[model samples]
Target: MANTKSAEKRNRQAQKRRARNTTVRTTVKTALKKARETIATKDAAKTPDALKDAIRTLNKAASKGVIHPRNASRRIARLTKAAQASKAATK
Candidate 1:
């Protein structure tokens, strides 16, 4: 319960931000999952595109401030490393 008017407004703003952030988070997670799955399945033809999409989504989220830039970069690095390992194994 917000006792002050400003507090109430802040709460409302938080709710809106939370909803928007959730959507972005979900998109990032889904993209990461798809990319990992494509890599795991050894679909070299599809993995690169999937990795590109996942990286793009992560960058978008970071730019929007939904996620930290460093956090997104770390994830992108890990995903890229895994993708490379998978590609090498397949080769």
Candidate 2:
């Protein structure tokens, strides 16, 4: 529905960016969920590895501007705390 040529070009660009951004968002969400599930199960052995992946994914998203750096930091903090708590509970 873009009336102008420039607008049409922008629309096309937006579509491409949206798809790319969505993939990054999906990665962040999936990593966080997997980390949380690992923590919940009290799998202390795997918590460190899972947390590492989650943090890596979060940092990647933040660096790519998909999410704010502060937001990513907060999520990483919460996930680490959860993992710690689960580890404590298991011991």
Candidate 3:
């Protein structure tokens, strides 16, 4: 569809970036979901690790430019708050 050679190359690059971003976004979503479920279940053995993994994935996505850093930070804050609440409830 690109009439110019440069435009064609750009389209290719865009396609590659799109695929990469999709995978990263999927990973972030899955991690966040798992952490939320773990927190809800209040699995003392798994909660900390799940939250850590979700935070790490979010940070990686932000650093890779797939997501905004502040967005990731906000999600991390919410997750941490929920984890703390779960802990408090367990005590």
> Top lDDT: which candidate number?
3
Q: List the RMSD of every prediction in angstroms.
A: 0.8, 0.9, 0.5
* TM-score of every candidate relative to the true structure: 0.95, 0.94, 0.98
- lDDT against the true structure, each candidate: 0.98, 0.94, 0.99
- lDDT by residue for model 2 (1-91), tens: 9999999999999999899999999999999999999999988788899999999999999999989999999999999888888888887
Report residue 18 deviation for candidate 3 (angstroms): 0.2
lDDT of model 3, residue 62: 99
Quote the positional error of residue 18 for candidate 2 in Å: 0.5
Which candidate has the top score in TM-score?
A: 3
Tell me the TM-score of model 3.
Answer: 0.98
* Candidate order, TM-score descending: 3, 1, 2
Report the Cα lDDT for candidate 1.
0.98
For model 3, residues 1-91, the per-residue Cα lDDT tens digits are 9999999999999999999999999999999999999999999999999999999999999999999999999999999999999999999
lDDT of 1 at 78: 99
Q: Could you give candidate 1's per-residue lDDT for residues 1-91 as a string of tens digits?
A: 9999999999999999999999999999999999999999999899999999999999999999999999999999999999999989977
Candidate 3: misplaced stretches above 4 Å?
A: none
